[model samples]
Target: MENVVPFKIQIISILATLGFMYFIVRQIIRGKLREEYSIVWFACTIVLLIFSFWRKGLEQISLALGVFYPPSLLFLLAIGAIVTFLVHLSIVNSKLQSQIKDLAHEVAFLKEKQLNESTIK
Candidate 1:
């Protein structure tokens, strides 16, 4: 927002960002989140930290990028990041589905072969 954020708000934002980074790191350590997947989250948090500390940062970036409105640029970047993350997740899901299907077929073939051998004996 072009409107001024109170000093309290800025401090709160910084604290919240640090908290988020801590949570992400914990998740990675616990194996709940993968490093590659956390990269986007970390990048976003870093950008937020920068903007929180440097209030004029967004305006400068918007001007440099030729965006008339700074908030819109932030929204655009957020949406792009979310879309990229979703696409990556979708690709991973597709691969897992294929692998699962192949495993099912292999298991079925082994059971059939085992049954045939038992019957022959």
Candidate 2:
């Protein structure tokens, strides 16, 4: 019975991962999610699905890494993925901020020039 429980859990995990991947792809297809963002999500889901399908491999890795609890490894991977995604977003946000500032300055200068020309005319 105990052996059956672990097998059931593994099956459920794979199904859940598949469902998540489907949701992410659907969002991308609907244009609700950008491809750039979806790429990270897809990679995360794929990694999770791979681990779920290969439970013995995951266990071996955990043992080799000296992690007593194999499930904790999953949490660690999830955290790493989230941190990577956030860093990517932060970098993109910084670039967009600089571009917006430059554009605002250019618009202001152009408006000032037009105002001066009108005043002189």
Candidate 3:
């Protein structure tokens, strides 16, 4: 037997997905979220909306991917997305650290040169 989600649940899920999409858009409009970062959120929400509308499609995808349990597949995808996003953030953090270090060194050098010139004058 194919796993089936109740009609009420599907409606709720679709509403939640739309609510999430609205939140993302609002954030972008408010300048709290950048469009580049919002792409992933929008993509994920769209997938959720599609799945919510096509109830049995997830099962078909799960079976095609050799995942015996559809919910497990969903969990796997969510975890994967989280991990990927985290790694991206980590990379950005590293770059920012390097840039901060370089800026600090340049500031120190400029301060030392200014002090030397003032002492000579």
- lDDT top scorer: 3
Overall lDDT per candidate, in order of appearance: 0.91, 0.84, 0.93
Query: Any residue pairs clashing in model 3, and if so which?
Result: none
- Candidate 1, residues 98-117, lDDT tens digits: the string is 99999999999999999999
Give each prediction's root-mean-square deviation over alpha carbons.
Answer: 2.2, 2.5, 1.8
The candidate 1 region of ten consecutive residues with least summed lDDT is 1-10
Model 2 clash pairs are none
Model 2 lDDT per residue over 1-121, tens place: 1231278888898999999999998998899999988877888888878877776877778789999877788789888888988898999999999999999999999999999999999
TM-score of each: 0.85, 0.80, 0.86
Q: How many clashes show up per model? A: 0, 0, 0
Off by over 4 Å in 1: 1-4
Error of 2 at 12 (Å): 2.6
> Which candidate wins on TM-score?
3
Error of 2 at 52 (Å): 1.6
